[model samples]
Target: MAIKFKSLPRKNPQDLVAPEKFYASAVGDGEVTMDSLAEMISYQCTVTEADCYAVLISLEKNIVSELAQGRIVKLGRLGNFQIGISSDGMITPEEVNASSITKTRINFRPGKKLRLLLNDLSFKKVG
Candidate 1:
């Protein structure tokens, strides 16, 4: 199977006066929910679907807990999850504090397995 994409018109950020160019944007087919994932995992292993789901839930909770503690969570061969923040600039270092933070988000860095998968992916253009 190939990843599907569609051409989208986008203007150049550096030159607003420039004509818009078409770029390939990925089109998602669908999403796999936690329940579906657990069922699929159960089929691949000896564990029951309920047990797989419970473990997945616990994994989600623990990942969040670790990030809350200002630590990176690493899932072997999966990737790393880290907390990222954007803050208002202050003239002096002393002026900066938690209140300066304007945004917080979780960042994911794919591991080698994902990277390799990316290297081998084929794309199909769709209308």
Candidate 2:
């Protein structure tokens, strides 16, 4: 008699999810487009490539301090937006200084549905 073993299933690297398709299909009776993103990116009265890069950079920075320097506005999903740090206690001198020194710290938070869609990392078999 020979011993037998069962091999685990192999995952195909080619099988990947389409973010654009997922975003479009799940926009809840709406469409997704480069224009839409461009509109969102133009929240600060401008839509240059530099502005876009600035926004992304601010998002990953010291958020608390960034807002204190001035208004840290971010364009969000569905044409919505968010302003950082309204109340006190969440602020420190360093944060304040950081905020003041940094220019245009934009932070965009995806909508609940968009977040859900992004969070969905389910894998499927290819072909």
Candidate 3:
């Protein structure tokens, strides 16, 4: 299976007079819902569908709890997730503090195995 992409007109940030260029943007095929994911996992082992669903629910809860505590959650080959922030810069080094933070975001760094899967990616352009 190959990924699908569509062309989108994008403007150059550096060149004010440059013509808009078309860039390839990925198009998602579909989503695998949690229920569907649990069903798929149930088929792989002795676990029941209900059990798989419960585990996924618990995993989500734990991941959120850990992230709230400012801890990085590393899922082995699945890579690590941590909280990242954007803040307003202060003039003095000591002037910066929590109030400087504008927003927080979850950051994911893909592991080697996960990135390796991308090597086989093929694109199909959307009409």
In model 1, state the lDDT of residue 84. 99
Who is ahead in lDDT, 2 or 3? 3
TM-score of each: 0.86, 0.24, 0.90
**Any runs in candidate 3 off by more than 4 Å, and if so which?**
13-18
> Which candidate do you rate higher for TM-score, 1 or 2?
1
- In order of lDDT, best first, we have 1, 3, 2
**Which one wins on TM-score?**
3
Query: Which has the greatest lDDT?
Result: 1
RMSD of each: 1.9, 16.6, 1.7
Error of 3 at 16 (Å): 5.9
Error of 1 at 42 (Å): 0.9
* Per-residue accuracy of model 3 over 2-121 as CA lDDT, tens digit each: 899999999899996899999999998999988998999999999999999999999999999999999999989889999999999899989999999999999999999889999988
lDDT of each: 0.97, 0.49, 0.94
Q: Global lDDT for candidate 1?
A: 0.97
User: Candidates sorted by TM-score, descending order?
Assistant: 3, 1, 2
- In terms of lDDT, the poorest run of 10 residues in model 2 is 19-28
